[model samples]
Target: MTSDRITLLIVDDHPVVRDGLRGMFAAADGFEVLGEAADGVEAVRLTGELDPDVVLMDLRMPGGGGVAAIMELTRAGARAKVLVLTTYDTDSDTLPAIEAGATGYLLKDAPRDELFTAVRAAAEGRTVLSPAVASRLVSRVRAPGGAPGKEPLSAREREVLALVAKGTPNREIARELFISEATVKTHLTHLYAKLGVKDRAAAVATAYDRGILG
Candidate 1:
């Protein structure tokens, strides 16, 4: 929780994965590895004790699962943001973690730069989703499952949201659509309001849940 460095708690059941992440963050600038957890139960305990700025969490573990840990952390009002770093990007995996209050979702194959960006965003209380995870959301939206009636999003907002789902930054999205950055932010805000979400990750998950991206 220092102002200068973003502290992290890496949570995974695999020793190799935890070791790699610890070394990676250690080699990176502006980040500090506070601790590591082998399972959700340990993750929760260390999270409460270390109070890391962000938790790089894995979904499946023997001792406890990530979704349950995230729910517990959210319920307890922990200050750490959970950024799910897993191998699975399926609907069942991504949707539940996002719904459980994860600040971001990223697959294990994510590039180092993308992972760093997502971690920084999560630390800043912003939501981030890897392109693959976002693509999965799009796929889910295209699937045949919709509840009765949900509020509609404007076409422009939908476009913005789609870009957000792909992990596009506001500037890049604006450039792609020939819009200003402020305009991109405005569209994001409107869409967030319509979707009842606070950030990009939640917005994408809600879009999938409501079948809005279709």
Candidate 2:
């Protein structure tokens, strides 16, 4: 990994997609493209060898598939953050990729600036998701089929969680609910403690898993 630049590995079965992403990064200043992989198997090998700061991964591939590759890489202790890049936007597609340990998900149509921003954020351990995808993921988690292994939160907590899942700031949520920001923070603290999550993204994921909000 280069010390100065944000190194990236582009992984996709399509040569066109990989090349396009590489060029896009190359034209930008903060990102340096380290390599490319045409399949999940190659992605795993590259993760071990190159150890890029971020991996721009595609979910559908011929060998090892995107999710499978992420599972393998993470299981083997690869340090790179996986950011799933795909065309699909459904709850099923987003949830599985996240559950399998993807740090972020961006649609192929994401604005270039947003994509680069997400890459930078993911490289630094912050989660990023396309707003629509984030909302869908949150809604699904709060929907039915969420509470099996996890306990549900109170209705007010669910409302707070839904706003959080939509990326609302604490102050903003407070305003929306006609409550104090401290109250919002208090609720988030309790929500995190109960869900065993430390941040907004994890809380959102857990909310969906537990059917606390939709």
Candidate 3:
């Protein structure tokens, strides 16, 4: 049977942020605040114990930043989807979290209703991005490259890479572009080989560094 409430584990460095999130979710319907963690280490530990449906993660923290925790959770095959709630939306911050398997990204200043919708979408394994972040990604992908000597990404490859850079998961990318997941993986493989990178993060970094993803 399907569950009615979405269970959440809120992870932020600030006690106030944690408290605020807890209080907000506690007052809402169709949601449950499972617990809170101050850093990535505790987030990972509690996630294992509590098994929340979604983790509202912060990007920057003193102990093992959010990216590291996201990577660890992906490696450990944790069941919870990570929805990043951070102050930073720069390419450096957004790309890593997405590559590390974050289900969605949202800014800390997002409206309460948007936050609620994002969490629910993430719990259903959908890709969510803040409007600013999405616009930034679109601009980056469409911007012309300064270095003309670099090998060019194919049109479709560029489309896939752009969505990937936007933190869109493979499933969503496939769905949006009307292709199969295997085709998306194939495009990623070719792009990775063309960019000479092993993973999504490296591919994005290389693209930016080479002015391919300006």
| Alpha-carbon RMSD, each predicted model | 5.0, 6.0, 6.4
- Clash pairs of candidate 2? 141-208, 142-213
TM, every model? 0.74, 0.71, 0.66
- Per-residue lDDT of model 2, residues 32-125, tens digit only: 8989999999999998898899999998888779989888877997889999999998877888888888989999999898898788778876
* Candidate 3 colliding pairs: none
Candidate 2 global lDDT: 0.81
The reply for model 2, stretches above 4 Å from the true place, is 1-3, 143-198, 202-214
For 33-73, candidate 1 gives per-residue lDDT tens digits of: 99999999999999999999999999999999999999999
> Which candidate has the highest lDDT of all?
1
Error of 3 at 42 (Å): 0.6
lDDT score, candidate 3, position 98:
82
Tell me how far the alpha carbon of residue 104 in candidate 1 is from the true structure, in angstroms, after superposition: 0.7
lDDT of 3 at 202: 53
Give the higher-TM-score candidate: 1 or 2: 1
What residue pairs are clashing in model 1? none
In candidate 3, what residue range of length 10 has the lowest lDDT sum? Answer: 140-149
Better of 2 and 3 by TM-score: 2
